[model samples]
Structures are given as structure tokens and as C-alpha cells.
Target: MTTQEKRNLIKGLIFISPWIAGFLGFMLYPVVASFYYSLCEYNTLKPALFIGLWNYIDLLTDDIFWKSLWNTVYFALFALPLGQVVAIALAVLLNQRCVGRPIFRAIYFLPSLVPLVALAVIWLWIFNGEYGVLNHFLGWLRLKGPNWLGSTTWSKPALIIASLWTVGGAMIIYLASLQDVPRDLYESAELDGASGWHKFLYITLPLISPIIYFNVIIGVITTLQIFAVPYVMTGGGPARSTLFYTMYLYNNAFSFLRMGYASAMAWIMFVIILGATVIITRVSKSRVYYAGE
Candidate 1:
């Protein structure tokens, strides 16, 4: 290479060196360490003893492991799609031109801006069975409100309901996507004497397909890793009905001093999340609309 070319290459490398170093040190090292730890038996105080696949094998026989896995699956199944759909619906409403629209959007978004722990605490009071607003309102209608966070049958659903509060972030994304839909397409549809429902079904839905795909992947990952709200609200109580996979992993690693086991669980969750993402992306190929496609 010429002298100028060599100097330019060095300068470019120097510009990006900090990012390269950070990725290797913080991201790559931990991923490598965790994978190695997942194959051993280690507590923080002692050396990691090689245990082969025993941790994975033991997970199959442990009831709590299965229960936490089940709870996680239950939470993800409902929370993922429900949150996405609600966010999309809100975005559709918010995208319409109306008086006080910005104020309405801000009001809807305020709940998500609250700290998650504080939000969970507030919802705990709101979901309180005896004197809570929800139950009190139900009583005004001469109806009974179930013991939400206090019942195994209802705790998971309560958490799912609480999950909706954070839909603002997703709604903003959907609203942006909605705005990007071409006005000419809607005009052309109108020329064909299309009704609002027909226009939305044929045009808005297809054009927003890519955004839906993106939000679905995000929702799946977020719901799968859900921890803080349920942790603060129920602490995996009500007969362990809210025992999320991450909460159980935290208990194993920190509370029980089973670092290696927790590492194994983390890797398993990583595989599950990666598999789901791949499946979603592959499925999206047939349905998601892009300008190029």
C-alpha cells in the first residue's frame, strides 16, 4: 500500500479503537466467561468445578425450575402480543389529527416514564382487594373484584395488566411508522371509493407490517426477560405463580450461591430467545412489507 493509504488506515483504526476495546472487554469477555461457567459448579467464594451437563440435567427434575419456566412462558405468551396490540391501537388513535392530541399522547406516556419499582408499588395499591380503586369501582356495580396479586389464579394476569403501562414506548414507534405511510397511497385508495376500514385493511396494515414485525421481536425479548415489576410486586409469591425465570435465576445465583447453575439457566434463556427471534424473523419474511420488497 502507498504511504497515504497506510496512514489513513491507521487513523481510521485509531478512531474506532475505543469502541472495539469496549466491545471486547465488556461484551465479549463476559459472554465467554459465562459460557465457561455454565459448564461448571461454582460459588463466588470457591473455584468452579467442572460438572459437565449436570446443571442442565438437574433442571429437568427440579419442580421450581419447571414452575418458573412455566410462569415465564405464561407471561410471555400474553404480555408480548397484548402489549404490542394495545400499543398499535393507541398509536392509531394518537396519529389522527385532533385537538389536544399532544396532551393526550403525553398523558398516555406518563405512566411509562415512572420508575418501574415505583410503578409496581402504585399498582400494588391499585390492585389491593379490599379497599382498592378497582375493587371499590367493582363494588359500585355490585360486583366482586378478585384478589389480584394475592391469588395464584390471578397474580399472573395482574402482572400482565400492569405490563400495559409501558406501552407508551412501543406506541411512539408505531406512531412514527404510521406517519411514514405515503399520503398518495391513501389518496389513490380514496379514488377507488374505499371506506376507512378498507383503506386501513389494504394499505395501512400492509405498510405498517415492518413496524409490527420489529415490535413483535422487541416484545418477545422484553417479555421473556421480565423481572423487575413482578419481582417488586409479588416477589414470586401466591404459590410461586409469579416465579419468573429470571427471578429464579437470580435466587439461584445470589440467594442460594449457585452461580454456575444460574449461568446455565441464563444460557438456556439465551438459546430460547435466539430461537424465537429467528423464527419470528423468518416468518416475517413472507408478511412484512418494505419498499424494496
Candidate 2:
């Protein structure tokens, strides 16, 4: 409407232009292309040929698709809850006033900074049935350690365990949330002779419920897309027990040259994650507390 307003608007657009360009080139284009590709049969060597809903139809009858879905579901179910508990516990500990607090925080958080591939490689050795550190420790305790990665029954569980090493990132978020909880509430509770557990259960948990909701949504999304660690560590495993959805998608796209099929799977995963997040947000609506609420 005015020269100054127009200049300010232009300057604002200029400042965010990199992000806009990136969103178009990297995110938006891929999303659009993936949707189109999902409707076709593609091999990178040749152009995609449209095939309508055949990919979705085939996936419905596909055993591996179901198996991968189930495996992914199992991983997400266990990983999210366990990781949340561990992160919150760690956060609570770190929230305490103590000696070497910064050092302890750094030590706990360092694992999350390790590359997933590197972490997987390290855990691969750690979970070795024989002559590995974990087994050796079990042996010292006169306990037998099963073949973790080699066993179909245990492989997914092992991956879940390994991935928990990165719960430090979640811990940091929880710790920050913990700090924002009103100190006066705790002091008031103390005046009433409230025990530590009582204070935490009634006050701290309520205040940090929003963070829990945020982290749960994030965990659900992240765990659903779990690929790197299992891909590197178990190669989807001894009996395909760890054949995650993404791993199968990768196989279809690269291993089998079924790019269109992979695209379909990606879209399905997107829908599932989106639905789950929405459901979680809706379910958490009443429980998640903010200062004003």
C-alpha cells in the first residue's frame, strides 16, 4: 500500500528466499514427484509408466509389505514409550542441582551426536552373541546371552535397545521443559509436606505434559521412518524379522528397481505417520497442559 511497507515486505521475502527456494526445490518438488511416481511403474533407467492403483492393490496382497508394516509397528510401539521414559528419567536426574552438571549433560547427550551408521556399527559388535562385550559381561555374571542380531525373535528388540542410545536428544528437550515448570509450585507443595514422588506426580508431570505430547509425536514420526540403524546393523535380519517398511521400500526402489512401488510405500508411510500424529494430538488435547490452560 505504501513505499516503506512495500520495501519492508520485499526485504522480508528476500531474507526468507533461501528457505522458499529450498522448500520448492528439495521438499515440495520431491513430494509432488513422489505422489506422481507412486501411480506409475518406474525404473530409474526408464521413464515411469502410469498403472493407477495397482501398486496399492499389490501391496494389500503382499506378505512382505504386511510383515514390514508389522515390524515397523512393533518397533514404534516399544521404542517410543521406552525412549520417552528413559529420556524423562534422565532429564529429571539432570535437572537436579549437582556437581559436574554440565559434564554429565554433555556425556549423556554425546551419544545422540554420533552418526546413526556409526552407532549401528558399534552396537553390532556390542550385541554379538559370543566374545562381545555384552556377552562377556553376561558370562562373568554366569548368564547366557542369546544371539541378538542373529535371532529372529530378538533382532527387533536389539535394534530398539540400540536406538535408545540417542534418547539424549529427547532428554535435553525434557530437561528444558522441566526447568520451565514453576519453582514456586514445588515450594508451595513443599510447605504442604509433599513427598518428591507426590510433587512430581501432581505438579511436574502436569506442567511438562505438553512436551511429552510434542516428543511423542516426534518419536512416532521418527520411529516410523526408522531405516538407517536396522539397514546397517541387521540388513533386515536373519529371518527378515527386522525388515522395516523403509528397508523394504529401499529394496523395491534400488534392489528391485521398482521405483514406483517404493514411492507408493513412501506415500502410505506418510499417511500413516500423519494419521498417527493427528490422533495423538487429538487424544492429548485434554491432557496436555500449558501455563494459560
Candidate 3:
């Protein structure tokens, strides 16, 4: 390389050296160690005994693993799409020429700023079986509400409902992307005597597909790694209805002291997430449009 090119490369490396050091020191070692540990049977105090694919085989026969996977899949299936719809609808509404729009945006986004523990606490009360706001309101209308977290039938749905309260961060991103869209597209659609629905269909939807794709991928990743809310509230209770993948993994690792098994589970989760992300990103490329790409 030329002297100037070499100098530029050196400057870039110097700037990124901290990140490189951290990645190698922390992330890389743990990732490789986990894969190796997954093949062993270790309980922290005991020496790691290499057991080949036994851990993998055990997971195949494991009921809790499957149950937790199902719970997590259910969470992702409903939460991802529902949260997207709510965020998008709110974004579209906020995009309107309404009075106090800034205040409205702030109000909508405030919930996302609340700590996850606080959010879970508030939701616990909201979904409480008796003497709770939701149940009390239902009682006022002479309607009986189910014991949400206490009942297997309603626990997962209640958790999903609780998760929707923090769609504000995604909504903000979508709103910004919406604002970046070209106005001429809408103007031209109007000149064609297109109704609002028609304009949104032919103009807005196409333009915003990229942002939607972005949000969906993020939502999927976050939903899969979900641990805090269910951990705090249900403790994976009501017949394991809310026993999510991460919670199960946690139990295996710390509670059960199955470090090797937990490592295997973590690797499996990594593979599943990596595969899903790859598929989504590949599929989205055809549908998502960059404004001036």
C-alpha cells in the first residue's frame, strides 16, 4: 500500500483498537469457551467431563426445553406483529397535522424510558387476579376477568399484553423514517384523486417497508431473549405457561447448576436466532426499499 493509504489504515485501527480488544478479551473467549463447554458435563465445582453429543441428545428428550421454546415462540409470534401494528398505527397518527404533536410524541415515548422492573411491577398490578385495576373495571361492567398471571390459560396472553406497553422506542424510529419520505409521492397520488387509504397503499406503505423490516428483526431478537418480565412476575408458573427459553436456560445454569447443559442450550438459542435473522434479512431485501439506493 502507498504511504498515505497505510497511514489512513493505521489511524482507523487506532480508533477501533478498544473495541477490538474488548471483543477478543470478553466476547470471543466466552463464545468459544461456551461451545467447548457445551460438549462437557460441568457443575461449576466439578471438573468438566467431556460427554460428546450427550448434552444435545438430552435436549432432544427434554420436555422443559420444548415447553420453554413453545412459550417463547408464542411470545414472538404475537408480540412482534402486534407491537409493530401498534407502533406503526401510533406513528401514522402522530404524523398528522395535529395540535400538540410534540407533547403527544413525548407522552407515547415515555413508557419506553421506564425501567423494565418498574414496567413489570406496574403490569403485575394491572393483570392481578383480584383487587386490580383491570379486574375492578371489568367488575364495574358486570364482567368477570380471568386471573391473568395466576391462570395458565391467560398468563402468556397477559405477558404479551404487558410487553406492548414499551413500543414507544420502535415508534419513534418509524416516525423519523416516515418523515424522511418524499412529499412528492403523496402529492402526485393526491393529483390522481387518490383517497387517504389509496395514498398510504401506493405511497406510504412501500416507502416505510424498510423501517418495518428493521423493527420486525429487532423485535424478534428481543422477544427471543426475553427474561426479565416473566422472571419477575410469573416465575415461569401457571403450569409452565410463561416458562420462556431464556428463563429455562437461566434455571438450568444457576438454579439447577447444570452449567454444561445451559451452555448447550445457549448455543442452540444462538443458532436459532442466527438462522432466523439470516432468513428475515434475506427475505426482507426484496420487499424493503431504500429511498435513494
Which numbered prediction scores highest in TM-score against the true structure?
1
> Against the true structure, whose lDDT is highest?
2
lDDT of 1: 0.93
Clashing pairs in 3: none
C-alpha RMSD by candidate, in order = 1.4, 1.7, 1.9
> What is the lDDT, from 0 to 100, of the residue 79 in candidate 1?
88
Candidate 1 per-residue lDDT, tens place, 3-115, comes to 99999999999999999899999999989988888889989899999999999998889999999999999999998889988998999999899999999999988888999
lDDT of 2 by residue, 1-293 (tens): 89999999999999999999999999999999999999998887998899999999999999999999999999999999999999999999999999999999999999999998999999999999976698888888999999999999989899999979999999999999999998999999999999999999999999999999999999998999999999999898798999999999999999999999999999999999999989998999998888884
TM-scores of all models?
0.96, 0.95, 0.94
TM-score of model 2 (CA atoms): 0.95
lDDT of 2: 0.94
Model 3 lDDT per residue over 122-189, tens place: 99999988877989998999999999999989999999989999999999998998898799988888
> Which pairs in model 1 have colliding backbones?
none
Q: After best superposition, candidate 3 residue 92: deviation in angstroms?
A: 0.6
lDDT of 1 at 21: 95
